[model samples]
Target: MTIPLPGLDLQQLGPEQSLRAFIGWWPDAQTRLYLAEQAVQAQVIYGGRMMHADHFHLTLAFLDGSSVSVLQALAENMADWPVPAITLDLTLRDVFEKPQVVWAGPDESQRQALTVLDQWHEDIWARLTALGWTQPPRRFRPHVSLLRHARIAADQSHRHALPTQAFVGDGVGLIVSVPGEQRSQYHLAATVNPGRAVS
Candidate 1:
């Protein structure tokens, strides 16, 4: 009797076990610098673990339950959707504990972005549902994730507020990452450039 060993490609198995997608803003250099400094200081002061500064992003939408190809197509369409560059001014309202996670609340502008994104999520959700996909259970929030897990004390909050920076989202991208890795790094599977119509 001959037995066959399963041949697997590790690269195909990423930090995540499921197919995940998110629409977010990638900050420019100046914004990245300011956030990095704040994260470092927060780490020392609050003892809260800091996310990789280079990976800092503002997630607008999250979706699961679609194939990579489907997500890629969605991203391609979004990149082609014509929309003006959105300018946001973020102000931290307060620090709040929501069950398992701690997050920084956003001001009016951030809330506005949340509203816009919520509508977009609905639109995408309908499309995916039509394609026979189930969505995740998490409710949408416009806040930025400051620290995760309670291992870090409340004292770890940054003494100085994070400075504000502006960025124009040039395109929408499809990103995928594996689970259990030290960092969840994503590659641009597709790029949807703004100010253009979908083909």
Candidate 2:
């Protein structure tokens, strides 16, 4: 049986307060349908909250705590970033066992793309640090988040597996949102064409 997809709200905050680099692409109708089905299945089996598919995204970098001038400069610097087009073949594996959060991760073929992005992140980090900004404690790992805080039970019925889908993405975006707000909405600050824009 088919299931309905969850609804979500999108927000766009003004410039200079928050920033991030990301890829923006929604799943096709078929994929969304499949995700809705899986979400219902997971909700029934796992007995926990399921993440709304519309909230899904692949984050490239988080740009927080920059002054207005710095943010403008950074925006100008990223106005043209040259990264190649990437097609990721995502697969669902039992990566998270506790507090189950289902994820679709890249295959071995996408490692180079991820590595290049990491290096780009390092470069960005150096630039930010030179301008007196600190880096985040955790390193970058690319993955598609499917569920969050999904409590799992130690029972046979809880093992309902979800199907994964592949996505083709070509562009990168800058996202901004409020800090310390539980349901603060994210805004798309800017978009860069990876194949043509300079990094």
Candidate 3:
């Protein structure tokens, strides 16, 4: 994961202001470039609005409509959250019908990394619950969304195959979603490095 520089002034935010935010892992430039290339190919095969490279991320927790105070608290306590260093292999190309999205996810063969990631997800949610946030009941399905509004059938999702690509994920960031005319723009608010001592 890339350590993102602050893009929003959290200190300037008013207490009642609500933010559409989430904590996620940002890929390094090289990995992002690779994903962008894959997205271009996927768009040709799948037909959809390809997500911009800058918008690519692996979401951990979606905190929609979170109050400024809650966001601030999360940022302040971020260093205390567990961030296990893991390597994710993006080789599974698939689609979700409800959202009409094409995405890349780790294949089942990456057991060790997937296990660590699963535990880390649970740990983060445990910390979030202490901050008065409720964990969503939905199961965690980790994937990097590549295209939206895709017009591909379910079986066509496997028409194209991805070569083995791996990236080290060792950090997390708080990102605010800014709605745009075409798609939502994401702004990095704060980040915490992996293996930092918990306060």
Candidate 4:
């Protein structure tokens, strides 16, 4: 998978029996660096588990715990996905205190990309529903999670200043959760690029 950026190639590295799955995109290197910087600051203020750099992504859909057969069917249905290459600005540093998740989401200036994301999300949900998958109604928010289980003194949700970065989302992948040495790891099960799907 290739982003619309020059000389930047977003590779699809292709996971599980009964897996906790989701659909998301790994942003470009610049975006990763900015997110990393924010993660460091968030940890200092919030005291949380910062997501690993490799696990940085903006999830489009979360497919709870799914059987292997359900994952296979979803992969087959994602081949000709309608995700076009688009750029988004990560400006909002949002925090949900109850869940203790700090994330970076697109600001209002990236409305065009958000619209495309909303439509693509609906499309994916519809296709999976047609396959007899129980998809609950969800209000989609485009954000890359930075910190989880955050324990901060003040209500700093969307109050901290983070470096603004532009992210190029050109593809989507099916990911599963796996046990890891330090934390749970996100493994890619299958991926569809801007024009094609690969396993």
Candidate 5:
């Protein structure tokens, strides 16, 4: 199978047995590079494993281990899943210490945008639940994981201020995650445009 985006070639990503997919929005090349640089900076400040820049994405829903037929059906059905274009301002650098994750996400300043993202997530989750997929029992929080296994002291851990970086997303992708020792590899199996579906 072959799927092509502006700078991505899915043919090279190879095949998958089951569609262990998630619905998410992918950033463009420039935003990707910026995220990677932020990861590097975070790694320098807090000792941890920095994520690959190419893997940076805003995940909406996790749909694990569905069949390829389901992927096809979802792609077709998503033409009616009209998502408005959203600009995510990455201004907050925070940590999920229990998970040892250092991440970036929209701050309180972008409350309206965050509200939109929350609603979008709820809409996708509802659709997935109706499809009989088990929902993970966690509140939706839109974040781009920058680094993993970060160790910080109690007083040292706080939200870091950074110059606002923006990522504009107009579509959602059905992405399959391939496991790896260093970092998980993600392949874009299909996409649902704000106005249409592309596969």
Candidate 6:
């Protein structure tokens, strides 16, 4: 059975804001710049914390408050797990006002890829659950966050056209993130790709 380690909680992780691990995809340089531009614009115009360019990603699964021990255990358990590589196409933007954030996600045309990604997420969740980890409560939403804790005008909120962007990730990865001043910062912990050697 997997033992939950509370000692390494976000509060225990010093100044970082979150105490969770996640399966996520980091964007390539060009994609990062494009996304950062959007986040920067939102922050500058609406007043909010801009996500650091280096940490731009689309989350696959949110592992709620897993401590170092559990994460290490899970990493070891999934050391050789192969995650297929996929190119996610995102072309729409929206503001989740209650949470005060801006994000972008795939449009209808990209539904096939999004469906595969969602299935991949489910498979991962099942594996982790079998390994003794508790399931996360939030439903999966295949989107990359731009600016968090944002304050946007009503007219500026909700869905709109975002320029086309695509990223072909090498593999899936587990990111270790902690709470940050402006936003939670992330650290890539474990990753695997059936398409290539384990990284």
Tell me the TM-score of model 6.
0.79
lDDT of 2 at 65: 51
TM-score of each: 0.63, 0.60, 0.88, 0.82, 0.79, 0.79
User: All candidates' lDDT scores?
Assistant: 0.49, 0.51, 0.78, 0.71, 0.72, 0.68
Q: How well does candidate 6 score on lDDT at residue 131? A: 80
Q: 31-115, model 5: which lDDT tens digit per residue?
A: 6778888888888878988877667777888787776666666666664675755667888889887888888888877877888
Residue 5 shift from truth in candidate 3, angstroms: 6.7
Q: For candidate 4, lDDT tens digit of each residue in 1-199?
A: 6322222111321233566778888776667778888899878877889988767888878888877666776776676776665667777787876687988887766778888878878887888788777777657878898999888556433555456678755457787776569766676666775454211
Candidate 3: stretches off by over 4 Å? 1-6, 154-160, 194-199
Q: Find the 10 residues in a row with the least total lDDT in model 2.
A: 1-10
lDDT of 1 at 180: 46
- In the range 33-141, model 1's lDDT, one tens digit per residue, is 5556655555454455665655555665566444655654465456444333445544452344443233433455465665765676666566656655576677765
Tell me the TM-score of model 4: 0.82
- Which 10 consecutive positions of candidate 3 have the poorest summed lDDT? 190-199
Q: In model 1, which regions exceed 4 Å deviation?
A: 1-18, 72-77, 82-84, 93-105, 109-117, 135-137, 150-162, 167-170, 179-181, 194-199
lDDT of 2 by residue, 9-73 (tens): 22223444433333333344455545555656656645555556554555656655544455555
Model 6 stretches astray by more than 4 angstroms: 1-19, 153-157, 179-184, 194-199
Ranking of all candidate structures by their lDDT, best first: 3, 5, 4, 6, 2, 1
lDDT of 1 at 139: 75
Highest-scoring model, lDDT: 3
Models sorted by TM-score, best on top: 3, 4, 5, 6, 1, 2
Error of 6 at 199 (Å): 15
Query: Could you tell me which residue pairs clash in candidate 1?
Result: 14-178, 14-179, 15-178, 15-179, 16-178, 16-179, 46-156, 79-192, 79-193
Worst 10 residues of 4 by lDDT: 5-14
Q: Return the TM-score for candidate 3, rounded to 2 decimals.
A: 0.88
